[model samples]
Target: MNTPAPGPGTLAEQILRGVGGAENVESLTHCATRLRFQLHDGEKVDQAALDALDGVMGTVPQSGDRFQIVIGGAVANVHSKIMNLPSMSGGGTSRPQSDADVKAAVRARGRGRFAWLDNFFEYLSDSFRPLMGVLLGASLIIAIASVLDALGVVDFRAEDKSATWVFVDAMWRSVLYFLPIMVAYNAAKKLKIDPWVGAAVMAAVMTPNFTGMLAKDSGIPGITCTTNATLGTQECVARVFGLPMQLNDYGGQVFVPLLMVAVLALVYKGLQRVFPENVQLVFVPFFSMLIMIPVTAFLIGPLGIWAGNGLGEGMSWLNGNAPIVFAIVIPLLYPFLVPLGLHWPLNALMLQNISTLGYDFIQGPMGAWNFACFGATAGVLLLSIRHREKEMRQTATGALAAGLFGGISEPSLYGIHLRFKRIYPRMLVGCLVGGVIVGVLGGVNTEAFAFTSLLTIPVFSPTGVYVIAITAAFVTSMALVYFSDYRTPEERAQANAERDAAEAAEAAGAVGAAEAAARGEAAVTGDRETVAADDRELVAVGAAGAVAPAAAAAGADAAPTAGSAGEGFALAAPVAGRVIGLGEVEDPVFSSRALGEGVGIEPADGHVVAPADGELVTVADTGHAFGIRTADGIEVLIHVGIDTVQMRGEGFDVRVEAGRKVSAGDLLVEVDLDAVRAAGHPTVTLMTVLNTADVASVEPHAGQDVAAGAPVVTVRR
Candidate 1:
């Protein structure tokens, strides 16, 4: 029975069911290509069913009670729909609401003192993951401004500018300048609190009245200001009531908000319990903000700044003293870090560097990793084009565009790199080479937190060095992917065989449709079964006429060659059995000619022999299948039984090895048909001409019993 494919919503519903419905799910999140789940009971998940869903690419079970469903690029939409499902409305209620419950549910993978470190990284990852699209948009705007600056059209860095240019600057600066407020909101949301309250608290310190203290004439009493000789920036301090407080601009402060939100959540939740349920709505926000605002400005704000500066300075010191190690390590680490969402802390540090030190060094070496990722995708695209792999071609094209133009690596990393095991190692080599080059050239630096894309190349200093390094990285990975290929040799052959079979079926179908039209039947809307019957009859008549020519070519030598007389060759019976048509075979791989034109034989005896004179190419370790190549370029595969690989050499004994010459009637293997049947497998041995597509025609002889020496298939090349 044929089941219709499901839409995204239906597929999402199926995924929910496969994961043991909404009750088993404790929390859900999604990245570029995976729907990450924190399940209450991982054992309850029906992994096999989930992997077989219509839109699902694969499934991954992590060390914890965590599972990931790979949905390629449409993962975000799927995640949204899954969260909004009616069945998921009360999903959270099934599990406890405490922090311990949440931790116990998601923290199965880690234990001991270091476990908190994992949770901390996860908190940081969730806070910034949702901002990726906006971050990329802002970076592109910076790229455009840099391009204008390069062409002498505008001085993007100048404080004095026209209204139009100032408005243009605001396009990207809005995201970076008010970044602290954004981080606060996201951090609060991750902790299951009111996000707006966190945003408001952060915004209070950034207000115009609070910032006015920096001005000497307009500021209130007890305010002092000075200019730093080293950084060439203004610094201010204000004494409110009795305590002195350091005044900072607070623009683009990431760590401050992250720290403030943690405190706010505790205060806000405590207020919720103290106030009556009726007044909780109004009193919670009122009391929480009244207390936390002062606390953030005086305590959390300065502490976060100190912590961020310390981390940035440590990295800066490393870069200054040991530039080579720092350069190489940044690129090497990113490939591993990006996929797990663990790189957000480093990103926050980049923003901190720009706000404090006036420039960043990490983006320069990091560009090598980004381009190496894109280069690997380019390799996949090249190979897909050469092999006519349409699905892979489209995937590679989309991923490459996102990587090069938008400076997004998630699309390529999840859609292509993570899926292919061979790509990461080759890509790392590119990363290493590019890093070495950048380090030797004294490294590159940027004054803005620009994304590492082709358009943003001008943002980095010494554009020549940056370009050369990235170009070498891109070319190296691309060549490796193209030359070595992403799939193994056996996998490639199986894929090729499937493609050949599809093309052959399509050609045969078209011929059948044409013949039906010639017989005055309806061409476009005719009964397909009638056309198929006619095609089979034509094949049978053609087979009868080709036998005489095949025998003439054989010249009584048993194995026939096209050059001797006929158009191609003939394959003799490999074992004594009833001759069955290819259509009668139970396995679709043989019945549909997916592995090329073949015949099935229900063996009457245990003995098997060579069908034609050829050299052995493959002898299965399980004693099931053998591949032989003849002199006229005819390759044939003799398979002993259906689904017999599971027998593991139990019911059969091999008498030959690969790369050995053998004539027709050579002993190959001895099989026990009763033993194969008792093991719940078919004892039908199949003989297929593997290179049938390269020949003129292949015809199967069936419906009657035949001895081991009798002819059963004729091939014309």
Candidate 2:
């Protein structure tokens, strides 16, 4: 019989179950290739099930809290699968809570569409996105252009003839002349502005007539004048009172347009403050045109040309003064360039100069390419093959091919490079090593108009040690990753199994001691019963004010000490909200209340803490409650309710943050019924952090009653 296919939720459950259930995952964030998880316990992982998933690419157990899962290009897709789980205490399931699970899940709160969107923006545009197209194009053009120029230069230089030289010179020069227009347009669009305006401005600056005029003996001073002719002599594109005067040629300059647009944006935004929206659009554009055009023409344009020239000249000087340093740094920064978007503007000058003067300065030395995509994918592929999980192995293999031949780099970045946090640093080191090889070779076979990978090596062309450098970089990175990586499946499992056996023996010895002593054994009850049967008991509200003792005589291992808040309603950190001011950890939200009115609420878990002082007014077993009257007088009413109450009991683990003076967004409970549902329960969740009687406006903003910690009624009196 054919095996049943795992649905998204089912697939998610299996993955979570294997990684020590919902308790294992510390927090989750997704990229294009895999789910970036901050996990607490990776040792108990069910590697076989994780390996079995169709989406998983490979696995790497990073040294930090992260457990990297290579899930192909469907990371976001799989994240959707995992998030659909009904939540329990602190993003956990219905399993009895552990302190580690509670503390860890606190990192997962405050994740919303906006937060995700912000991260998504960073994911796509910041470093890698803008130049990917240009990088590819540039690399290809460099190869092609070099060949064309070489054909003529070889013959001309060899025979001292003008014919071949003139033809090559004319064609090469023509493209260079038009190059500024392309850069300006592309840069403008990337900045979210009108491309046509940029193109028009660039075209005006680069016009031969303008160049011809500027070629005057000393230099033509800035005298803004208007000119319409596409081919005119000594004309200015912008005007000073309609007087036609000579001006500097600065077309194709990157920063000129950016400066103009930024100023225009400021004015436009300021106009919105004063004018109505309809007129704001018109007048803003009109005013921006009047202001920015002249400023750009007179000030920004000239400066940009000067700056670009200066930058190019500076780079030129560096190459001359310390060619070795230039070589070393270029490789160091090149790989980083693709990922950080800033590389486009910086590298534009190099490409421009290459177009102007045959072969880039790297033609002598000081050149190299980043082998990130190739090296990372190759490493991933090796891990995939070694993985016992079939689907994960297959995805990894495909991701590798994409990096090698298809020229896409995501597989390399998400699938391989980030497998271990340290790999990022290692890749940078390897890139530099390879860059030295190419930098020293400094012979030009191909010039990149765009960035690309190893297959483009021949384009760098027929012979050169630069080719060897590129190959060496890949080999070096792959080798490093391989060695720096973790043990394979069988090995890790065998080690774990062995350790478990040892632990079991020790436990047996302890048990034997207890048995012999007759009264040495502690009577076990529930999950923690094995630890301490005489545990201090506290309230565990089921649905109503109806409560059960959290544990019969359950004692906190580490109770409040000096400076720690004493137990009142015992806020027990409801739902694992990250505390700031009581600040600590990754990204703190708001600080303590020494100077403040209300405490900040940037909860890490999807649960809320009652301010420790509230009347347990009405609990409907639907998992919602209202608390009142604290020293702060904020009258906090926190309701742990999510969906249709299918997760009624599994919904919340409340300890109370009200009734006692509590700060904002405290962890009072742990709720991850979402995982409970994903673990095969129905999807109904207890919803709302509510308001019973009412207040004018909630001190906090209210939101949809979706999941626990989801905003319900933030009432204000």
Candidate 3:
């Protein structure tokens, strides 16, 4: 009685269709929440249709060269299919038509900020932007520092070290390190956000002398700064409670100060609700600082530092206890990095401690893992560069700089990882081969350098035995990259081949429809479409704006004419937004409270309207997201944003439970929008499809506003 949901690939194909098909696309990339792309002809896109998509979050014009589609978590899957979509010549490679267009593509950036925790990743991403500059500074400083220290001009020996060495090592070690924070600050500002406060917190956290203070290096205010018979004198103790802190004079403990600021922001938000705005600012920041600083310093900072140091110690212990097993871990993790970004910070943290840890076992993982992946990406880039397009070469060339030398993986990971999925096995083989060599030969860590390339391969080969193992990593990676049949030469013969193929196929399906389209295919900017759910039981959705009721679909008032509405579908509340976890729930699932694996909602008394108009699928609850399959086979996953799971149900209200059939206008859930707002969160509701491979099109129903019964999305065949 029900059809299976469309696969994620199907949804990608449909998205390509709406965007004038694969040939129309020039190139694509992704951020936290959107699929950023450049189309050969802006006129060919159906902006309204794309926005009206049921699973789509929204659309925005970003920078100068990009048109962005908000697709949330499904972005990666969709991006892959779009890239691999079939073209007339055989492969659908995005090709730009003009030099100016290529230049614009190189310069444009979208104004979206990822989650605060992802700041670590932002640091790495930003590394590529000023890659040459930052690397130059780091390489030159380290190189010069190494030279000076060797020449006896610089010393940190305390007994023999010069003031110059002390100053440079203590202060300059992390000089270009804050590059990540700076990048995020500039990027967020472009998004129109004031990040001065956040940046200030980061600056304090990264301050050279701050770590010492947190480590109890700065004289504890109340505790007497005295010579010790137990342990050592205050001046000699570099650790507190068996915890390590890398700093000169002490004072800046990052976590506590950051916590203070965050708590202060929370206080400001709370007071703004009742107290007058003018009075709240001073009091909020003032009290937040007053309450948080002492608490953080005396408690949080010490605890966090201890935990961090302990973690490092534990890893050290593990490596010391079992060297062989330790050697193989990196190769194993390299393959999984894309799916589970868990160890992303391990490299940075390893670097942070390397100054003291001396030789590291962790470096074993670094050898062939990313290098193999990087080699694979290099192959993809090289292939892209040689393909018959000059404009694409320019962009691919820039991307290769990061992929080849700097080891920033996005351009390679997203650009090549998907294109040559089969190359993964070879990459893994290479990694395992390297790991086996490390484990067998005892490849101890030298020291970590910032670069990840073939030239720097020896640093990883501490025993100077890298002739074969490291070479194996490169040869394997390159072979896989080159041999994997992601595309063929026949495919790159012409530009726009993919688009022409799709158009021709569609033309074959309905000549009459094609004629009608020819008559009305004029592109209209700012157009909107609204229609009722085709069925009584499914919901209809529109963008986040005032919706003209279905009665007005033909009333000539339906805004932005000539826009086509995709087929409709229905959705149900997954969980109450505020409820953190249901009974027996495990893993990260959507909460009714916030996004991640949660179903967020607007609470109040309201009908459970159809999310979009399609036949109902089971309203099963994983206690996270409400899983529903549209009639057209699109699987809709409506999740709330991150970390709302701990709320325990005070954050939101749930109206319709699972399996309640209703029309597009039927109220599904009247949410507690105010409660969520009061709790200080952007109520950006995301209704995404986990299985978007089969979905043909998504129509946006959410606009700048939402009244009752407003259509937010339309899915199509």
The residue ranges of model 2 lying beyond 4 angstroms of the native Cα positions read 1-264, 296-305, 333-367, 372-427, 438-464, 478-717
Q: Candidate 3, residues 188-286: lDDT per residue as tens digits?
A: 333333345334434454465554453444574332233322112232223434544333221322233333444445543565565776786566545
Predicted candidate 2 versus true structure: per-residue lDDT over 1-717, tens digit per residue: 122233366667666665666656667766445566676665665543454354454443444545556565566777777777764235543334589878766655434446665443343333233333343433334345444444443432234646856575455344433545554455455555555555555565556755655543534454345432211223344334764433665532334544554455465466657888777656755665566666666676666544543444456677668877776766675555433223333444555555655445442222334464467456656754553334335545655554555344544554444333445666666677776775666534445433344344454543467667666767877777667653445554553432222222222223223322322222221222222111000011111111111111012121222442322222222343322211221111011111111112334444555544445443323233334444433333333332212333345565643234434454455566465546453222111222211222222222212222333322333
TM-score per candidate, in order? 0.49, 0.36, 0.38
Residue pairs in clash, model 1: 568-717
Candidate 1 vs 2: which has more lDDT: 1
Model 3 stretches with alpha carbons more than 4 Å out: 1-193, 206-220, 223-307, 331-360, 387-430, 445-464, 478-717
Specify the highest-TM-score model's number: 1
- Ranking of models by lDDT: 1, 3, 2
Candidate 2 vs candidate 3: the lDDT winner is 3
TM-score of 3: 0.38
Better of 2 and 3 by TM-score: 3
In model 2, the Cα lDDT at residue 348 comes to 48
- Scored by lDDT, the top model is 1
